[model samples]
Target: MAWVYLIVAGVLEIGWAVGLKLSHGLSLAKPVHTGLTVAAMAASVILLGLAARSLPIGTAYAIWVGIGAAGTAIAGMYLFDEPATVARIAAIGVIVAGVAALKLVS
Candidate 1:
């Protein structure tokens, strides 16, 4: 299903995003991590392209980004002990709500 591909794409988007952070700008630093980051980025984009063939591009892209943003932010708070302020949490909630609305409407 296209939705299944879209969901996989979204999750891999999160992986590549966090990988970018871990890659240290994909410099000479951490070569393995950098390579893996590139790989994840490729996979995410490919899956997204597949999903786009069947789904509305706008809705699909929005959901992809929504999943990436929210997943990364939550992982940052959980793994990196980043700030978990009320405002940031609420912003995440809004993103989630928007994603849900898109899913329901489209």
Candidate 2:
């Protein structure tokens, strides 16, 4: 189903995002991390394409990116000990608002 594909795409997007960070800007273990990240990104694009075949582009894209953004923020805060300040939380609220607006307006 398109929803399944969308979910898969979102997961892949998060994987690629984390892989990119682990890639150390593609400096250390350049080939391995870069290749993994590239593969994950490609898989995400394919899954997204499949989802977009049925879902509206705006809606699907908003949902996909929203999941990725939320997942990444959580990972950053918990895994990387990154600051989860009020501003960071507010920015997440903005992202959620944007996704809600797209879903409503579409």
Candidate 3:
């Protein structure tokens, strides 16, 4: 259950990150996007806290951030037409590997 929360939180982190891009620096003209971004951010933190109740802080934080960073990079490539270079993909792969290693060790 805690793992589930953590995973969902990580996904929400991706959502908020993408939302930040969409929000255009959180301009007032983009109120909807900004609101949604803020909501996602709050929810993600809350879920992270819930997961932290059971998981080690260092392990949970690393995994959460790893998922967010990797997932956001992928999202940028697909949704925003960002570069999908081999180097970028390899970097994401490394982050995923690290996250997996943390999960295994924890």
Candidate 4:
């Protein structure tokens, strides 16, 4: 259950990251996008806190951030037409590996 919370939180982190990009620096002109981004951000944090109740802070935080970073990078490439170079893909892979390792040890 805690892992579920953490995974959802990490996914919401990706949502907000993409939302932030869509929000155009959170400009008032993009109120809808900005609002959604803020909401997702809040939810992500709340879920992270819940997960941290059982998971170690360091491990949880690292996994949370790792998921966010890797997922956001992938999202950018697909949704925004960002480069899908080998180096970028490899970096994402490394982040995923690190996240898996942390989960295993914890």
Q: Best-fitting candidate, measured by lDDT?
A: 3
Structural similarity to truth (TM-score) of each candidate: 0.95, 0.81, 0.98, 0.98
Model 3, C-alpha of 70: deviation from truth (Å):
0.3
Summarize candidate 3's per-residue lDDT along 48-94 as a digit string, tens digits: 99999999999999999999999999999999999999999999999
- lDDT per residue for candidate 2 within 20-47, as digits (tens), equals 8888765556889988898999999999
lDDT string for model 4 (34-64, tens) is: 9999999999999999999999999999999
In candidate 4, what residue range of length 10 has the lowest lDDT sum?
A: 20-29
For model 3, the stretches where C-alpha displacement exceeds 4 angstroms are none
For residues 1-106, what per-residue lDDT tens digits would candidate 1 score against the true structure?
A: 8888888988887887778778878876889989988898898889989999988999999999999999889988986799999999999999999999999998
Clashing pairs in 1: none
Model 1, position 69: C-alpha lDDT score: 94
Predicted structure 4, TM vs. truth: 0.98
TM-score between candidate 3 and the true structure = 0.98
RMSD of each: 0.9, 2.3, 0.5, 0.5
Which sections of candidate 4 miss by over 4 Å?
none
**Candidate ordering by lDDT (highest first):** 3, 4, 1, 2
